[model samples]
Target: MNAFDSVVVEVADIEAAACFYSAVLGSDSPHVCLRASQDPTSGFRGFALSLVVSQPGNADAVIDAAVDAGGRVVKSASKSLWGYGGVVQAPDGTVVKVATSAKKDTVPVSRDVGELVLLLGVEDVKASKEFYAGRGLSVGKSYGSKYVEFAADPGHIKLALYKRRALAKDVGVSEEGTGSHRLVLSGAAGPFRDPDGFVWEASASAPLTATA
Candidate 1:
């Protein structure tokens, strides 16, 4: 299915970012990698990483841990028609979200993240979707030219695409950006850059989990 095995985030401060992500992501990770870079990126950067939890309480706990670890809350945790969730921006300007479809707590609050989703905000959702589909990703969900999600492999990071402006609004950031995305995906189908400039490396080049 060409499922993603991990993600690499380029951060300006290696030592600090290592510690911050460790605290926020906890032990059960969706295989996030950190690389040191000082890429000249600004504004939204066209992507957001999401931590999907089991319940609202877990969402809150994740959000709180992120805040305690030097992240700024872009959207406060709250209930919405869809459920409860919030957005936070790490010190290095990486946008992350903690969310859940369950409105009520199923278990006691803990830092248990059920799934991790990498959302790419592209200029054309349909084109991006087709581009990925051609490379072997099976579409799991879709909303015309607005959004599309690919089926996930067991215990692997999920992938999705959203329109650039809509994604920025959802993540509470500006859509305008230039320079590198400062992000990379590791999967079996890659060693290529997507239509919107997202870089992907072969999974053989990345370990299941790493920092710096």
Candidate 2:
């Protein structure tokens, strides 16, 4: 099945952005990275996604495809100050960074890969629905009375427009500092921020176990 992959963040520069991410997550530089080429006529091509570590057994091939697709290299593959290592950029504007351990093993750490589904606050639910529908994303069944799920990918969702206050209460968190909390869900999980700035995540994984 077509699964949800990584979330794409449009940045002005791949190297600078990678540095910021490494600092924020306290991880090493991205092992696999890509930079977009300067070609307006290149049609649907610009920027790159870098992976700090290799992915499964498809590292070399994936890097080649990214370069062939018009992505430029910002930083060649190298080790970082941290023990783990990564590549900088490819062609498209997306920057990807993975951990060194995963790269050496050439296996994905998570069983399921996921994407970040942004829940934008809209003035009207019906109006928002129509806007996304026009973009070719299918709206799916509603979850209870508050949420209306919209198909993001083939089997995943992007936006779950709902009443702002109600969603905040459901998630058991205040809208303040919503973005600060990193909610890691199971594979292919969709996490979103509500209209009122409330954050919520949906996953099909088992509950978290308490640590001593």
Candidate 3:
């Protein structure tokens, strides 16, 4: 099964980013891969990292931790059609989402141990879906043209795509973006750039330690 084994977000200060993520996501946060861009114009705006909690209250706690660790709130927590979620901006402007599935008879959340997903905003959902399919990734479920979620290997982060503007609205950001994504994903079927300019690389590395 195809999966996002891990995601790397480029930050101006690697150690600071590591500390923020570690404090919010516990000790097993995504591995840090430092990419100090010479171009100061680069800032992330398109994608988001999701922290899936087992309970709704846990979502609130995670968001609080993020704020205490130098993050800023982009969108306040609330119940949505999909679940309860909120958006926060990390110190370097990378958006993070904290969500928990709401128990519902019609749309129940699956019981899975994996608690993370790297959500990318794409210019065209159909085109991006085909691109990933060509690389052996398959869509497990979809919500018309606005969003599509892919099946992932157990214990690996899940992958999902949504319309760029819709994603921006959901995360409470403008559709406009510039420069590098400041984000990367490992263990995609192959390396490719989505229509929205997010890059995925085929590589793996050890998780960032507190001393890193």
TM per prediction: 0.94, 0.30, 0.85
Model 1's TM-score against the true structure = 0.94
lDDT, model 3: 0.73
Q: Per-residue CA lDDT of candidate 3, range 1-212, in tens?
A: 57667776777776667767876766654544445443343444678877777655667777888898899998998887777878898887788888878633243333222378778888888888888878888789888788999998776778899887888887888878787777767774647776676678886755653322
Give the residue spans of candidate 1 off by over 4 A. 27-30, 205-212
104-205: candidate 2 lDDT, tens digit per residue: 444544212233243333345666566545544467756544556666554332445655454333222232322222212222334554333233333332
Candidate 1 residue-wise lDDT, 44-105, digit = tens: 88899988999998888888888888999999999999999999998888899989989899
**lDDT per prediction?**
0.86, 0.36, 0.73
Off by over 4 Å in 2: 1-112, 143-145, 154-157, 170-173, 176-212
Best by lDDT: 1
Candidate 3 deviates by what RMSD? 4.2
Clashes of 1: 0
RMSD of each: 1.7, 16.3, 4.2
Best by TM-score: 1
Q: After superposition, how far is residue 29 of candidate 2 from its true place, in Å?
A: 14
